[model samples]
Target: MDPISLILGAILVGAAKGSGDVASGAVVDAYNGFREALRRRLAGRKPAQTAVEEYTADPDNWRPALETYLQQADAQKDEELLASASAVLSAADPDGASHGKYAVQIYGAQGVQVGDRNIQTNNYRSGP
Candidate 1:
């Protein structure tokens, strides 16, 4: 995924999980942008507005439905639409899910600040 999309997705998800009703900061802008993009794609298709609203209101419940549209966008090779859908989906399920399980793992670090740096460690080291 592109860096912009990734960041927007993260912000949107954070806002969705953190904000109560109205999102603030980049989250609001990102959500609006994604929604507008998705709206354009759904213009010809009815029930889209409702679906989008549902996603905005309750993402966790409507994620699967949104994903269906995402797949359609993928099949058509519509990168823009795909990114928009991905943004919404990411915001809906920040933890991310695939095949009925979490796709991303969260690891905690002790006595250190884990910034953007990537860290890998051997969980089962045999000897020192």
Candidate 2:
């Protein structure tokens, strides 16, 4: 396989494994801050310096405002958020089954079955 393919595959697999929700709030916060900063910039203001400085000065003050913005945006649904949280919990498991299970299912559906044998050869391999 090409090196790029390998890297891309790894990234997809990792993303499927999911991550904890601990940083999600922070991500939403930063996203809102940046968006707000852009708005300020477009309105003829120093966004990067002023907006970021104000945000950093009192994150608590921005939290409620960001939450309100998110609520109004309707970009993500409650089910979607719950799914994300579940994925995070599943990925944190020590057994590969939790995260790897989904990958295995996808591979199986695509007709790439892994048998009891340890060999990694694909079914599509050409033989003499």
Candidate 3:
């Protein structure tokens, strides 16, 4: 490969990785925020009533905001966004796999298998 092509490829990869990181961070932050809010509510601390209104006032909703950041980080490449979103979503799930191929068995009243469902699992990992 030409030097320029190699450099471009490296840049693209770096951007995708960065986008994934940003998306993952945003999701984690949102999760933490929600948890804190819940804790405060449970503790009898009344949350601001306008919080939801303020959130909705933003042009992009929560998920869309994170996605916009990811897209910008990846130079607006559809493929890059798809790849990064997959990575971020996987990071949010238990198996660390980009796609869902896992199932959770549901039990009935008598502990009999009733059905199965797919659930999103959020498992975080530190650096190797």
Best by lDDT: 1
Q: What are the per-residue Cα lDDT tens digits for candidate 2 across 42-128?
A: 344343234334443454455344334434433124334323333333343336434353233232244343322323444665688
TM per prediction: 0.41, 0.23, 0.21
* Model 3 agreement with the true structure over 12-96: per-residue lDDT tens digits: 3233433444546645543444334323332432222233223334423342343333333442233432333333333445363
When superposed on Cα atoms, how far off is each prediction in RMSD? 12.1, 17.9, 19.5
Most accurate candidate by TM-score: 1
By lDDT rank, best first, the candidates go 1, 2, 3
lDDT of 1 at 26: 45
Residue 107 error for model 3, in Å?
Answer: 32
How far off is residue 111 in model 1, in Å?
Answer: 36
Please tell me which model should have the higher lDDT, number 1 or number 3.
Answer: 1
- Model 3 off-target regions past 4 Å? 1-77, 96-128
Q: Report lDDT (CA) for all predictions.
A: 0.49, 0.35, 0.34
Q: Kindly state the number of residue pairs that clash in model 1.
A: 0
Which residue pairs in model 1 clash with each other?
none
RMSD of 1: 12.1
Which window of 10 residues has the lowest lDDT sum in candidate 3? 1-10
